[model samples]
Target: MLESLKFFILRFDRRRRFFRTLAPAQRILDIGCGTGKNVTEIQRLFPSLEFHGVDLLQDSQVPPFVQYKRVDLEDGALPYPDEYFDAILVVHVLEHLHRPLRLGSEIHRVLKKGGRVYVETPNWISLFIPSLAVDRSQMQTINFFDDHTHVKPWSRQGLYAYLGACCHLEVEKVGTVRNWLRLPGDPFVILAGLVIPNRGNVASAIWNLTGWRIYGVGKKSTH
Candidate 1:
């Protein structure tokens, strides 16, 4: 329920900006597409483009335009031919895997030459202060580690290095989001000290402090 609500609140456009940079007619693959939320948004945004979604859990609600496949991304190969997709969306999913590099290599294999891939992961470096100040009980309620089935947390530099080692992809962009308060002291501590008790205030503080999340777009080398 919370996950669904979060998806709706984030809206599709906020996440699709990188993907929309490509020309129309590019085939897109969405890995770890939970509940088909983003897939539906993409369909509405690009009606003519082809979209494919894959996940371990099969949800009947998958959008009509999105062809959902049940598969474990941690396994050997993605169930698709080489150069099957021109663009891939991996929003907040790479952090959950045990072997992300292997999966990245597979993503590289399946993408067409000059294809683009957008990847996102929680900014662990940004979460340091917040995770420390917030009580574990409160933190657990927030599900910071729940959906984070990921084996290890990631930093922008760490992710770029790993992806670069796995494949000949260029790191186009790297930055954080959701932080807005720009406070001097620990934003989480300051947020926890607020009187009115703004829920989003903490998130904004984290973003300002740590760049909350890290996103990057990479293009497969044509060579």
Candidate 2:
């Protein structure tokens, strides 16, 4: 029951909208596809597409649409042929690994020419919010670092530079999202920041200004 609730929340329609732009026949891979939440959504939105999921642990309840592989990305190689996938999803997984560059290169190795990769990670920008007195914690909430295996928390510049070095992928878009419910103090501040003229600028500024969270879609270069 708990896992079902998680699936519903994670499968937000807005998230699917971003992914549906990929071609329908493309083979999709989801790295660190915990409990197949994102994979299920992808299957629902693009049922005809081939979908594969990999994670450190295997769960019996993974949806029928997903082929599951159990492998520790931190300790071993991705067990697949080169250029195997047409697109890959790495949602909220990179920060938990020590070898992000190695994982990026592996993802590049598995992606066919002109393939796309969608990645989302917690924004290290949230740290800046506390510095600006917009939040109470001097750092991100406990959940941000709760994973014992997490090696690094990446800033936008850090993540982009790291991925760029491993593959010919270019960041096509960059954005932020709020993960926590706003409180009275910070909520009003965030609201005022949005209402101010040049709302995009305000939002971007606040987003970039803090160590919140960053997400991006990148297209693998064909050259």
Candidate 3:
């Protein structure tokens, strides 16, 4: 039951929404794909679309028609020709980059003009919310640095600026997602929503302020 609930929350996450948006792309690349889990799910929905996954670790259970490449992104350039992919999914991957600009340039190079690039990163605000954390220690640390490898924790605005500056991509959508309800704080929000008129919007705004993930969708410049 707990796992089911988690899946329900995941379905509404920004990454899943980004996945849905690119269902029609003829070719999709999943960078830092980590076993092609996301792409495998996407293939279940759109099986005809070609999928490619690149990660440092090899996946043992890869699906058919999906190409998996074990590439050390830190050491070398991605092995695709310029403008090779129709869409690129960078979900929860940017923060791990040591040279985000170099990879950003490569992403821009491999994606066709007018193609979409979906980026989802941890919201800086989530560090302040304990319910968003997995343990007491994480809450105390309060920076989502539990992994220690998350070198870049971006806000929605930061995501927009980085993509615009580095990749020269056109920003199409920027917002928060997985703005789930918390314990004490959300109960009050729910109460306010029930008692006051148009206060639901206010409550929603509050939750968005504390949302867990910052999401961005950008288009490769047609020029």
Candidate 4:
């Protein structure tokens, strides 16, 4: 239920931004496509489009529209030839990668000219919750390694720099996913905080902080 809710809130925004460049792609590849959820969601939005997914596990319960393959991206190259895919999606996958740059290069090579890559990863800065009076390093460490497979968290700037450099892709947008739920009750929280010193700022800042998850879309350089 929680995962589904997260997906529901995130899906529309992502879909809107991602498909802005290529509304209807000829062929798309999804790297690290665990269960092909992204692919399934995208296929629903664009039913006629061709979708392919590559992940370490082959037991994904993917829909008929998606062609699923098992590939260890950290060890081997992407199976497709250069400039084959019209677009690619790499959602929530980078942190688990041991060789993310290599995958980025492969993504660059596989995408057709002007193709776009959409990526979302956990934001390291969000791990530090100042309001809760948590230790920064310890909190960061906990969040960073919450998933045992995660190599490291990526800051928004770092993600842009690495992907841009590795793929020569033009960055479209890079920002954190604001906590939408926190927005509505901020004024009340602020009011309450005035009675209690340092409470308002802490309450309001939670929503104002743009550090939950960093996401961006980049287009392959045509030249």
Candidate 5:
């Protein structure tokens, strides 16, 4: 559709960077997998790797090859042995947790030695980002607290510490999450919003322009 084309040209997607962080692993676990977008994306990117997913609810959308478990991230433990996964993804999951560190501990417990874990969440800037839409109900959330599910926000430094101190993982970061190939479209998207703002796309594009998300890659220590 025409709208879909506009969204692609406008909205910034961070999947490419996240995928690169997970590329080195053979076995991957996605915490808070939701309805299996992570599973589908990973499968499309690297079909040879083993994939597992855990979520608060059941998902029927995933392929047969994926191992899935339903878990309450705060109440129930991640039911995997220590150092089990080669790479783990906690994309947009931590902000929803009441006890995020509990999951972080489990992430460290399940991740293989020297294996990578990629965590992405909204930064403090998410608290103030305004939606471009005139009718607010039509817009996807631009502010972090707009999603009542989000318990807290994460900064680049805070995420770095969360992985290092709580999880005992060696952490790495590059500040904000962005894709160079798509970044050139940001200014045009911002300008387009003034005349013909696609509410959903413009909000997401604005967030990317403002660096609303913070992320880090942590590797479980070998010794």
Candidate 6:
């Protein structure tokens, strides 16, 4: 019931397409999976699907449902065989790398032909957010540099191009990720930001209005 409500408010159409596009996928990979949040939530909807995750985090830090592989994306290739995953997700992880696009080849190598990849990263607008990291502990990521790990920032055009040049990848779509339905509450979120000074959830709504994150999706060529 809660998930359905969020679907309507935060991301109705995009969420539908996200799940619908992957309904036929047999196996999926989440790159830079962090604490396995992506796979954890996805598993609820795809109990029968095989899920895998690769990240620099300790195996114990990730959820058990996923096959977690500890890998440093900067030093070496992903620890996976070619043509393995039917779907791959790289969300908010590329910026941490010094050369963001260096892993494109590895992504192409691991994803199956005709498989799809979804990549999202902080766009140029994310760089312009003011009052970056006021408290140091909270209210950070709204300003891209607040996360010192974010060495490289990306734009929609760059991500779109990376998919195409990343080897046998057919770029399907590129756009700023925004919850158009959330627009109505943006003013309240902005006003709350001034009063409560919380960049966590309050800023999320404002970011949606600004289209702070950009995304691109591409499919590996069968040939």
Write the number of the candidate with greater lDDT, choosing between 2 and 3. Answer: 3
lDDT tens per residue, model 4, 1-223: 9798756655445444575445658898988877777777667678788889888775646566778778897874899888999998888788887778888788888999988888888788645643343333333222445446778778989889976898679998888766565556555655564556454254334534445577878898888
**TM-score of structure candidate 5:** 0.85
- Candidate 1 stretches with Cα past 4 Å from truth are 1-14, 126-148, 178-209
Consecutive 10-residue window with the lowest summed lDDT within model 3? 132-141
Candidate 3 CA-lDDT value: 0.73
- Specify the highest-TM-score model's number: 6
Candidate 2: worst 10 consecutive residues by lDDT? 131-140
Q: Give model 6's TM-score versus the native structure.
A: 0.91
Ranking 4 against 6 by lDDT, winner: 6
lDDT of 6 by residue, 106-197 (tens): 99999898999988888888888774443445744777777778887788888877888864589988988877777887879777765776
Best by lDDT: 6
Local distance difference test scores for all models: 0.68, 0.67, 0.73, 0.71, 0.77, 0.79
Model 2 misplaced regions, further than 4 Å: 1-14, 127-143, 178-211
lDDT over C-alpha atoms for residue 166 of model 6:
60
Per-residue error (Å), model 1, residue 20: 2.6
**Residue 26 error, candidate 2, Å:** 2.1
Q: In model 6, what lDDT does residue 24 have?
A: 89
The residue pairs that clash in candidate 3, if any, are none
lDDT of 1: 0.68
What are the RMSD figures for all models against the true structure?
Answer: 5.7, 8.3, 7.4, 6.9, 3.5, 2.1
lDDT by residue for model 2 (60-94), tens = 75676788888888863788899989888888788
Candidate 5 lDDT over residue span 42-135, tens digit each: 7877888898888867557555777988788886379999889999888898888888777777888888888888888889888888644444
